[model samples]
Target: AAPAAAAAAVHEVTCSAPVNIAVIKYWGKRDTALVLPTNSSLSVTLSQDHLRSTTTVRCVAADEAGDRLWLNGKEESIAASKRLRNVLADARRLRRAAEAADPALPALAELPLRICSVNNFPTAAGLASSASGFACLTYALHTLYSLPLSVSEASRLARVGSGSACRSLFGGFVAWEMGQRDDGADSMAVQVASETHWPDMEALILVVSDARKDTGSTEGMQQTVETSTLLRERIASVVPRRMRQMTAAIHARDFDSFAELTMADSNQFHAVCLDTYPPIFYMNDISRAIIRLVTAYNRLFIKPVAAADAAGDSAPAATSRGYRAAYTYDAGPNAVLYLPREHVTEVLGLVNHFFPPPAAADHAEYFGRAASAFLPAVDPAKVAALAAQIGFAPFPAGSLQRIISTHVGDGPRVLARGHVESVSLLSATGL
Candidate 1:
């Protein structure tokens, strides 16, 4: 829309990444400051449709005192913690060196980075915001700095922001190694398998509740670490066995084995959460209802299979022929269900039946107070029109907002076609 001369001078680079929810959860921390885990954890990266963060890092030399960050087009104050700043500084330094090494190199660090990020899904709803945020940040910084950091190295940097962020650096199935070193240099993530490797895998993300939790993971983990003796058994005994079994299941393409292990591990993680001193409550009524539905569905399907196999006089086939579904939950009310791709529509239908939209009268009754206060002088017809514009639909008379469905997907990637700009003095001089 502007002059060609103004447009040609600016260069932009955009990067995007998807969020992942851990099945074998990373609950405790060995080094809180470094965000190191006490034990290894595994997660599946979901498709960008269900949840994702898109970050654009454009460099410009402006007279600003410090870098700025924006989320969904609104300016946000950077977190007070210096971890992110340190990572950004390191990337900028590398960029500067790259510029110096080549006279033709464009200066990228001197330009102020206008970072605009948006989470397609809810933030702080226990849906892994750290996973997407840190992954997107790392990916953007690496590109902006012109650094040769591999995905592993970028993951290590992201780990400093949040323990699970490391896993988000990779696609599909990923494992975060809990390094022995206290410094956390060895703590990083490695991909187990690409989404292509397991073509039939599908994830159904049920958004049971979007309300922000009162206690953050940091505080909750600290409490559990200090008090829960059951957690000692979980970390020392239970998780290691489950981790090994899960790895084997993924490799062998054993859905039955995988489903059983995934659900059990999730339950154990929540069990440890409840055993904490004063008991931190992560799951709610809606979450339990989802669990009940999944369990009943599994039992209903498995019963028929068991009965059919048992009736046969010949030796029963060990492997499952029909589609299998498994449900796993994280720290919040959201449920991540893994199933065969063939059953996706069936799953969606079931989800929709459980959580329908609110009715028009119910919506009016619920929002009547706010509507009355805001539009006291407006016409009744106009008020109704305004309410419709706000996207207030009658959901099934319940608390749940909606379901977010996604499947396993790829990690962070660069978008070269977008606008780009140099951040330093050298680039401005066209050196």
Candidate 2:
């Protein structure tokens, strides 16, 4: 047995990773266990300040016991979670090489890890929660052992946990290229641009439902692969072309092409879901309403944006005429909107108008289901007034629960490592 001092000695690091919403959705998997996507995908990583997973990993001397993970204060068995096991194993494997190269490396890899992860946004709400969750865990592990793995290699480790997670390891725009090799060696995420490159890119996350997804991404995609014949044609023909267009759009900073391709790909992905046998409907009534609203909003600025693009800063109408925004969704009902910073106020104002605040009598609903479900930063007084004027727009109060406003952001970041004592999630309950 280890000494009491050694038992209490836990080396830990807290890492935060941003959530990524795929514009070119990775809906089907070629290899389930290996997590190889059927087609390549692209995404914009949201700012960590708004939606992220802050995971703290503690490594101490231990027996052959398995690793453990706790999310949002609830302990989850690591053994039962294959995704988690793969993530930890990848990090430890990389650490082994590092230890061989440097003898001074700590023996943290030999010990079991205690991981505590918390997310500011709802879990499994079609917002790519797993993307940030596993990315943050792997990052904490990489930092704890001080491994020298490249960003791409580290992202590969996260891909084993969630396909979309690979992109979370990078910031701004990311592309998860589905490698052709069966070994999946070349299959990894690549950054399209840094957060600093496109300073105006913004994300408006609409929380349609905060509840756990009725059908998880893995399960839903698995079913679609088996039942939907359309999935094959999409991987073979549709995604390849879409990926090219999206890549070009990002490189050129062409918001018009970016918006068109993003919305088109989203619609096609959902269309594939419907073409599946027994059919899967990831988008509900609320999700459809959001699509209509976003389309209407974009109409105001599309012509202006196009004119501006054609003129390239010469057009006077370009500055104020168009709405530089688009919306996309994943395997759930939630909506992720992409827009420029100049229009956030107007768009948010419209959002408030549609989903107004509840009456004072419904305080519990706001603090309870509404609170846990959404995080719209609008003033309650304003919402109450909007509710009176709109008289219930399409759905009820909780239908559009939260609105997360963020933008193109960098990848996993190490926050305040020097002040470890303060950032510790374990706090007084020290490991």
Candidate 3:
């Protein structure tokens, strides 16, 4: 009994995972039960410094209650979620296999587990919160049991919860390959580039609304599959070619090609959503306005390059005026604009001019990460000229709730066990 107690004491672990914005979005499913995708997808994992989901798992006494889970400070019935059960079962299976190979391993498999998870950002609001949530849960479980699964194998574990969650297992740019097998053994996420490979890649998440999405991803996907013919065209012809082009773009660090692919794919995915029976409208008027804003902003850089080419200027200077920003949307109204580090301040200033915050909003919480740098005011002349070019005026104040500035970042990380503030969820609600 004493040895068992000692072993249980050592079985706790805390881990956090980053939210990834899919540039080449995943829409429908091939296999609903296994959580397989209809097409391969790619995404950029956002830095956890600004957004993340943190989870802590620990073994409870055998005499205690059954396996349980608490999310965002509310206790939920763990047995009610098949996705949660599948992940827990897979982790135990791996732990048992490891223990059988090594007889010295502690016997912690039969003990009940208490898991508590929370996201720093909004949940179920079309912000890829599920990606971080499941990734953090699976990672914490793997660490708690000392499972011997590789990162790739760990990603497969995350996939059973949420399809995009698999991509969050790797850092930087990642691709979830839509494998050909029915068993889903080949369907896994692979890293295309490390976070440091493209240090200049940065993003701004303009959160239009934090309220829960009206239709969840699973239901929306099912509806699209049964009704939309465009999804068939996307799966058959569009995604595969784009996957190759996107992978190559990331490798070569070619922002022009990368931006083009990112924007086109986002548009098509939303188009497929609209083609669904009765249609699903994820983007509001605010979302459409932001899209136009990005289009005009990109065009502002085009004129200079066109003139440089007409003048037969050197290649170096002409290329410097290439596309500076790309915008993509997930299954929500929020917009994530990817840009070079140099352009963040200027573009944000434009956003400030157009989507000015409400008078009651706290100025301190308005911008995040690299965007916290004092914004150099954009020239009013430039803003007015660009607005005229797009044929749209500035939006009402508070059209956007907040903007989070982050960069490409690494995958899941285990937090130090002694960090009391970070681990407060475990005891705060008595999980």
The model with the greatest lDDT is: 3
Can you give the TM-score per candidate against the true fold? 0.79, 0.84, 0.92
Candidate 1 vs 3: which has more lDDT: 3
Better of 1 and 2 by lDDT: 2
Largest TM-score belongs to which candidate? 3
* Full candidate order by lDDT, most accurate first: 3, 2, 1
How well does model 2 score by local distance difference test? 0.77
Instruction: In model 2, state the lDDT of residue 376.
Output: 46
Span of ten consecutive residues with least summed lDDT in model 3 = 309-318
Model 3 lDDT, residue 162, Cα: 93
On a 0 to 100 scale, what is the lDDT of residue 329 in model 3?
A: 88
Stretches > 4 Å off in candidate 1: 1-11, 93-111, 303-318, 321-323, 354-356, 360-396, 417-431
Model 1 lDDT per residue over 330-419, tens place: 778778889887766655544444554354435433322222222223344533443344333323554555555567888887755246
Q: Tens digits of per-residue lDDT for model 2 on 209-250?
A: 777777788888888899988898888887887787778777
Model 2: worst 10 consecutive residues (lDDT sum): 310-319
Off by over 4 Å in 3: 1-8, 303-321, 417-424, 428-430
